[model samples]
Target chain A: MNNSEYAITVKDLTKKFGDFTAVDRITFDVRKGEIFGFLGANGAGKTTAMRMLCGLSVPTSGNGRVAGFDIVRQAEMIKRRIGYMSQNFSLYQNLTAEENLRLFGTIYGLSDREIKTRSQRLFQDLDMESMRGKRVGDIPVGWKQKLAFVAATIHLPEIVFLDEPTGGVDPVTRRKFWELIYKATADGMTVFVTTHYLDEAEYCNRVSIMVDGRIEALDSPDNLKKRYDADTMDEVFRMVAKNAKRAE
Target chain B: MAILNALIKKESLHIIRDPRTLLITLLMPLVLLLLFGFAISTEVRNIRICAVVDRHTDETRAILERFRNNEYFDFQGLVASTEQNRMLEEGLTDAILILRTATGNMESQIIVDASNTTMAQAATGYIESMVSGQSGNSPIISSTLYNPQLKSSYNFVPGIMGMIFILICAIMTSVSIVREKETGTLNLLIVSPIRAATIILGKLIPYFILSAVILAIVLMLAYGVLGMPYSPASIVNVVLFSLLYILLSLSIGLLISALVRTQLAALIVSAVAFMLPVVMLSGMIFPIDNLPIVLQWVSAVIPARWYIAAMRKIMVQEIGIGFLVGELTILASTTAVLLTLAIVKFKSAVR
Candidate 1:
């Protein structure tokens, strides 16, 4: 229960779809209440690895735990402890925001009063109370992303896994979204996020750069820059990506 | 339990908001029932026939007159000889009846166009009855033929019920599942604590309820509107048969949904792969017994065929429950097997 305890641990985890190895023998750990960024190029297996840790997919081999539950033996427990906002648009497009939130709240098993109260309060907190009646498909993509994030975490899960959550958002909206992430982390929820944006990696407490089904670099943004003798995480990413390709 | 309740609620919202799905769910079955009941009929009626009275005798005219009153044939022209061939050839008439002139010691001969056999047979029989003067009152003979009463609704009611069940249960089940896939909500659910089985159940339960309601509506239409038999045996038989058929269709749909990545693909697969067997070999359009030996076995696996057989027995034959147990067993077992495979395959495929 200590704050410094590991919230997620993966040792030599791997996944293969037929002959294609999506996630190789990658090992990592996420401390409780920390923002852990998973960065990779398209098809670098970042989403695949995140999926395994979230219990959406079973690993071919290795061992892991999420929120102190074994990934192998207690995948359902792991799933219960995590919230996921997938890269693809996830919310029901035809439903109003209030209805969507109520449904997610119901899925989380909250009482009717709890769902009513929480949805009203959350919309107010997000400054989106006026848009609650609008269908999600009618709203801007940026707003939908933010609403999806809120819907994903309505259950107050211990860890929230966001896969490319800010893919198509404006810079200002992305910044606001990061503020939401920070707010959640501050409230003691661990943020396990995947993004292609290196700047987003800088906002994380630590990050792992995956290339070709393996993690080629893992450190804080400052540490990775210093270790690779680069000015920015982007440069460090390119260098590690080059070496990962060369090694393969 | 909470997650399931929430997910189900969310799904209901999607179904309600999507006007296309709402329209399909509420109206499709009833529309199809009405279409099949009132519009489509297999009984050949009002068929046009031309007769040639070569002798112009009173007896021959009496025989020709029978075709006018015959409900089966629409007697068109009573030409002497030249126009007989022209009428049959131009499609103005389905058959030509030629009464040959008699010789001193010869009986009069009736030559009917061999083609268009149903009309030929009806005309020929009417002529013989007139000649024999056998006018004693006898009961209408409904001897062996495909659907003896020529009741289109007798066969169509069951056929439409099967078709409706397939459309609502199979297509609707896959639509819900594929929507989840397309929107990436399925991934979210998979990653959540919800079991794959629970997700499948959630997708199925609504459609099942909807299909049951559809079945009830169709049954009422078959009985009340069409005046098809509505005995307890037929009603119970259709309900039970359609339920099993729904499960089979839905399971196949779920299996296809799991295999294919897109809703379009699921729709195509359901139509091409599932609907064909139900329509062709299920004895809805073509009788299974009349098919080639290999295809007869093929029809054996078609749940629609079994349902149609069970329906015909209950509705037309007025058979008791003992006659239906075999078909019912096949339907039930097939459903169970398909459902088990669907659940097992979906468990991994979604992940």
Candidate 2:
């Protein structure tokens, strides 16, 4: 595929913290409009890698581009063109769901009229209209996770990054959250999500399992399972993670 | 500009929704004013005195009459010398005056309760002037300028203004920023397209307006309740100086927030780091000149020291800007340095 056809491309991307390398010589390409899942055990450098791609942290040595902008030189441009959500629920709990939506929309340079219309439509589509004026902290955890996703995507960027967005939710809510990811893909928006739940890996179009700052395996889940002679993604994850050398 | 407006709006909502912040903003000034105005005073009034005369000469009667006419002394008539010590011990009289005729001259003796040394010294001085009619060889007339009654509250109003503004602005801004950091919202903000400088400014603007409102309340209480002299020029000067001081305090808070990770740590650091300097080195409760040379040098760098001095000149002395150029320059320069440091630290932290 041509360079323009890729949503993200990295060539030898590396990040170091003093004597330790968090992401070492990583290279991959995320196709446009694909739901790519990043799988890693605890402290396997998934977050450090995502932080570099989102332009929140500079890479120690390497070259990378996200949404066609250089991650290091054009961080501000990358920020304007992408959305990000963390596991901790980044919305202001003191603010209402609608207020969070409006604030993020305005930050992304949306007009007042656009914010009002888009917020109304987003809430209706999510069936979260009842939460329009309620404080985020007063809502259930499942509902807050959904609202945070809406807040992150309010500007409708070309790509969205979800860092463990379904952490600590019930299985039913986790399933519903994936439905939102699929909906974004249906709209032709690329999704780069990180998760520890191996079962969720099966839903992704492609998956990269990292162990000790290196991408140990990258392919479709079916291919990984067949190649490893495993019956399930969990067994495949155990096989990949057992080879990690980093104690942390 | 739109992003800034949105951020400011969000900050304002946080302030409004949090009852603790509203309480501090609204009630703290009034509580502090009443505390300093009424409870913390150094003025001495109505000292109790008993007179003992060995013989009732017309001269002695006339002298006793003089003491009775003065408002500062509350005269308790004719106690025997034996009862003088008893009255003082019972706290009935603060002092005793004894007059006797020896040879052709009238002799006088004053025994005062010296437990509170300042008040004792002042009472003795008053008795001596009344008896001798003059302590100096020539009659000397003295007049008090500005605050003629020498009200202790006058000395405290400027100090209270300096202390309250710094405490509220510094503590509130630091805690608010650290709260966002602890909640992980600061990370969200950093990832947004808004500039770092804009975010810092957005955080400060609400506190700026709130500090201004608190300043106005403090000034109103100073003039209305404490009876501090007020003029339009003095009001302008006080407002201007307080604004500069508030800006400096907000910058200090921002600096602390940038360095600390948790809201509790931010609160403790801001309180310990700022309160001591503001109260001790700022000349709020003690005179800067009276402090040790080392402390005096430290006071020169404290923003509240200059603010309290400038505020006294503007509000009480009613001086013009020309007289306060040195103080205003120091405060303005310090504010610039702190704000630049806070912004630089914040940028690096986010990166």
Candidate 3:
């Protein structure tokens, strides 16, 4: 993906809640069809900044465009063009998998027949087609995570935002979840993801680490590791975050 | 249109899937309606009364017979001797009716137990009308005490409005939002293309309709089944007050949900801090006028009180707009303010 293939553009995006700044001035761009990992810890402004990109929230003082729409003036359009999954594993536990899928599909303006066809295809693709009838609460956590991803991108959004999507899944399940993420990107959906998992960050085409509400480093996983003279993404994260805090 | 439909569908799922919210939303109105219909009533149809017939004359006997026939009184043990004091001191009955046996003067003296004025007044009116023709020129002097006329319905109508408003609006609203929060579906909605206004309206519309249904059911029971007077204007008053009260109640519910992360906390706060006051101080089951001065002032701040006041004015007194303008103004303004606050709080929660 070239510069012309940028799916999201951020210019000094800042978000403040009262006097405490949640996301300090941070800028980055996500290219089309690329798995962009947003790495940050708790209260590191990861969620806040993602919220801005998702168009669910506005930056306190910044200019940005998401999915080729102005963040401020075209938020509604940006919201329409993107999918989001929060760390809490967003799915209605009470409803059956089919009901949840149909709901999101319809909300995204899919017709009844389209929703029906898409839902059937989604269940088949996930290899848990029979689980569609079961209540989401009764399902295993791994399946729920994968279902969440499908629901988020059911409309085939140009850009999909995943906020720590694999927060508590087991290692094997997390690997399977990454496979689904890769498949989504292969279909030309831009994956703008946030996660605390350093290994997951390593799989990203490009990664940005946020600390104290600011992105301290942005580079390809290998380049970040090379720059910090570290063996792994985890060590690179520790070194950069430490230096970023010290600079502050 | 599509977004609104999605929200409605999601909201319905939340309401139906969560047992706690379903209980509060559907069962509350039914329970309160039954409780008020059976246990709480203003019309004293079978009030226990103790009457003293001073002289056992033919005319007086006939008059006493008239009293016995009256279904409103449950002629408790009668006293032929003039022991009015004993009748009341022993709590024998609500009031004592004295028929004078002054032979030459031919007059009737009716004394009522002043403690319960409503009973006294009703008994007084009955005796006066019964004996008026008994002795053509004789004078009938009746004195009433505590709550003369026993204006039970007058006290109940407004109280009903307030109680129903809290149950219908506030409890239902909070429970609905809390259910969404508990199920983790709120985030799903936030991710959807549904607009904020659409979300708020979607959650509120069903509860509003349900409130209307409750008002209709209770009103029908109050009038058709219970033999309470059916006032066309009062029915309109109930409907209008209910719509406004639902908005206020829903707003309170939304505010509670927004402030608290969990449904349990929202439920607790809404019940203790909101529902209790609207039920008690709104003067739905109790009279704010009789409450302490401080409580009376407090009642002024309770929108339910104003709603009840408007209901009472329209239904019981059959008063005109002049009687309700003040209460109506207060209720309307409070609703606007609460709704605005709720919107702001809801926005913050989403953020």
Maximum-TM-score candidate: 1
lDDT tens digits, residue span A181-206, model 3: 99999999999999989999988999
Residue-level lDDT tens digits of model 1 in A157-227: 89999999888777898999999899999989999999978888899999999999999889999999999
When sorted by DockQ, best at the front, the candidate numbers are: 2, 1, 3
Q: Scoring each candidate complex against the real one, what DockQ results?
A: 0.68, 0.75, 0.48
Specify the CAPRI tier of model 1.
medium
Give each candidate's interface RMSD in Å.
1.9, 0.8, 2.3
Off by over 4 Å in 2: A1-3, A243-248, B46-141
Question: Which residue ranges in model 1 land beyond 4 Å of their true spot?
Answer: A1-4, A243-248, B1-3, B104-149
Residue-level lDDT tens digits of model 2 in B1-351: 999999999999999999887996789889988888898776666888999988887778888898788898898889988998899999998999999875556789999999998789889988888887732443766688887987877888899888888788888999999999988888888888889998898999999999988988888899999988889888888888889999999999999999999999988898888888888888888899889999999888888889999988887789898899999999999999999999999888887
TM-score, chain B only, every model? 0.88, 0.88, 0.72
**Residue A54's lDDT in candidate 2:** 89
Candidate 2 similarity to native, TM-score: 0.90
Is candidate 2 or 3 superior in DockQ?
Answer: 2
The candidate that wins on lDDT is 2
Pairs of colliding residues, candidate 2: none
Candidate 2 at A45: error in angstroms? 2.5
Worst 10 residues of 2 chain B by lDDT: B133-142
Which regions in candidate 3 have their CA more than 4 angstroms from the true location? A1-3, A243-248, B40-154, B178-184, B231-233, B258-260, B318-323, B348-351
Interface RMSD of 2: 0.8
